[model samples]
Target: MFSLRTISSLWRTSKTDLIVQCQQQKQRLSSATFTVHPYKLHRIDEGPSTEVTCTRDQAINYYREMTTIRRMEAAANALYKEKAVRGFCHLYTGQEAVAVGIEDAITKKDAIITAYRAHGWTYLRGVSLVGVLAELTGRETGCARGKGGSMHLYCDRFYGGNGIVGAQIPLGAGIALAQKYTNSGEITLALCGDGAANQGQVYEAFNMSALWKLPIIFVVENNGYGMGTSAERASACPLFYTRGDYVPGIWVDGMDVLAVRQATEFLAKMCRDGQGPFVMEASTYRYFGHSVSDPGTSYRTRDEVQEVRRSRDPITMFKENIIQAELVTSDELKQIDVDIRKQVDEAQQKSRTDPELPIEHLYHDVYANMIGNDIRGITPFQRHKHQNTSKPCNITI
Candidate 1:
């Protein structure tokens, strides 16, 4: 008979061996090919293949990034419940793959603009969690100096979220025009929700981009429902990708990160080759309400959300694939989750406690040339001075 202590010792040794074996396999892993759902095409000859491949390094990075976004959004939800974040707090809880995959396929030289559900996009576009969370909390250290709040957070070449629906479509086209005019050899990815699909301006932007051969990709992140209304009930034609009759379109599986990456890589090359102005409808889903004020369960059932999480969650599905491929072990992923939770928690604390911007900055960055001085305040009795200065200083005109 074996002693209890001896058996315990053997178990520990075996566990260590398993971990070492997993690590060795991971180090040997170069890349893995994944089969994703076929993309639905519109007015296009051929779409990207369903067989998507990514390197081990890329997979780890994608998992880390997507997990971080999810955790950040969860923290944001908690902060909103605690009343730390206010005034239109949109959480990117479920649609993380779209942002991470797109960024993976694009470069910093490329510009991106999206709707107000932009926490993920902002972070992926070089803004840190500290910057994004601080902006949500209206702290001085925010990306916008707390002036832009939740709906606006910008970085170099990355335009922040726009509040008004369908507003970013035309703006994205204009950015693409700038890119073409300056010969920047860059592209623009303009994203809008399904609700914005019906906006007349969206079609106008599409028409303009198609006519001018703008290096732009109009992306409709159709998350099934927008602002608590179902896309099917709202639009007579919900096939948003096909809405661009002249421009080619692809309806990608947004839940699959690798799929999004592959599609984006194809489109980006086409854009640089002056064959752009495509429409990509990422059929995704969001787990939260339209904003902090909304109760998401009112329109959709909890069971539906749970079903999606259990069956089609981007993070879980990716994790399963990599795990099955022996590229990573469960223990390694758990450690990553722990580390990300700590990072997000620490940033959340800082965002909640940081001081807000001073009142002197109220009128800052309102002018460039300052055509007139002594700008009037809310009422005629009060007047403020305008000095055409840099983006950091105050200007009132």
Candidate 2:
């Protein structure tokens, strides 16, 4: 025997089914439909927003930056093979998106500080290719006068290519402090690697920056490994993004340039507005070793690296997406490649031929010498004032 409630339930089910059928029929005939999928309710990657306002020219500029970095890294690799660059040199071959995307979100006056793998950031921050390449080659005309090598490249707006593991974190915080002290309406991007995430200073900096509301963005370039050690092996908290408390962190798809750019812009804005420190852990992979000396294959398998290159290469992924959107063509990208190659070749030649440093230049910038103290024996007072300031001449003239 059917109860009254059972009969009502059956009738309601029939009515709901008829309504769904009518809606489906209407959707079939309509030009557009806004049907919501229950599966889509599952949250995926989220930041400010993935979409951005970019013109064709702006898109090309991004392409240029990424391409330049790739070519520069290739050139560095070639130089290393020839034994031109000695010591620890970290390559930014597969991590172009991190720098380019973050660069777009900040102004020209803003500061950028990163770990040892910083060629890409300095290049993006308006340092000339020749200057950077020359520095790596130890030429006198380098931005740092050839004193600082690959792991110490620096420029006006960009802080460094720091050598110490994770030491750049506090330095970035200090730069942010300077910005805050002067009330500069700029944000500082402090980038670190997965391996450096284990450094204690990173947490200390995060704590201080968050407590005092410093305008800084802490970025972790989680390329799966810190040097040869995998993130899982090195970091107890493998999720580098949400490691500490107070500061909220977001994980980003580092292979998608647009996604990185949009997310960076959002985070930069938050920090610039005095929202304190924001953490971003970009899931990126580097194609090279921690340094030029290591083969980069000792720890990870060749297949794993190749898989990332084939499937998630940031530059390639961006090119495909842009082409699909009719933003650029293969022919145009090829031209860009040709242009970049030419520039890199010329820069390499320039670096090779850069003049040798004079012996005097070594001590010129070493210490702050007060005026009239020409330790090299040529005193300005002797020549102009007729006073022998030089160690009293032995001959009584």
List the candidate 2 regions with Cα displacement exceeding 4 Å.
1-46, 367-397
Span of 10 residues, lowest total lDDT, candidate 2: 33-42
Task: Report the lDDT tens digits of candidate 1 across residue range 56-147.
Answer: 78888999999999999998888889998888898888899999989999989899999899998999988889999999989988888788
Deviation from native of the Cα of residue 191 in model 2, angstroms: 0.9
Model 2 clash pairs?
none
- On lDDT, the candidate that comes out on top is 1
What is the TM-score of each predicted model, taking all chains together? Answer: 0.90, 0.81
lDDT of each: 0.89, 0.78
State model 1's lDDT.
0.89
What lDDT does candidate 1 reach at residue 344?
A: 99
Q: Each candidate: how many clashes? A: 0, 0
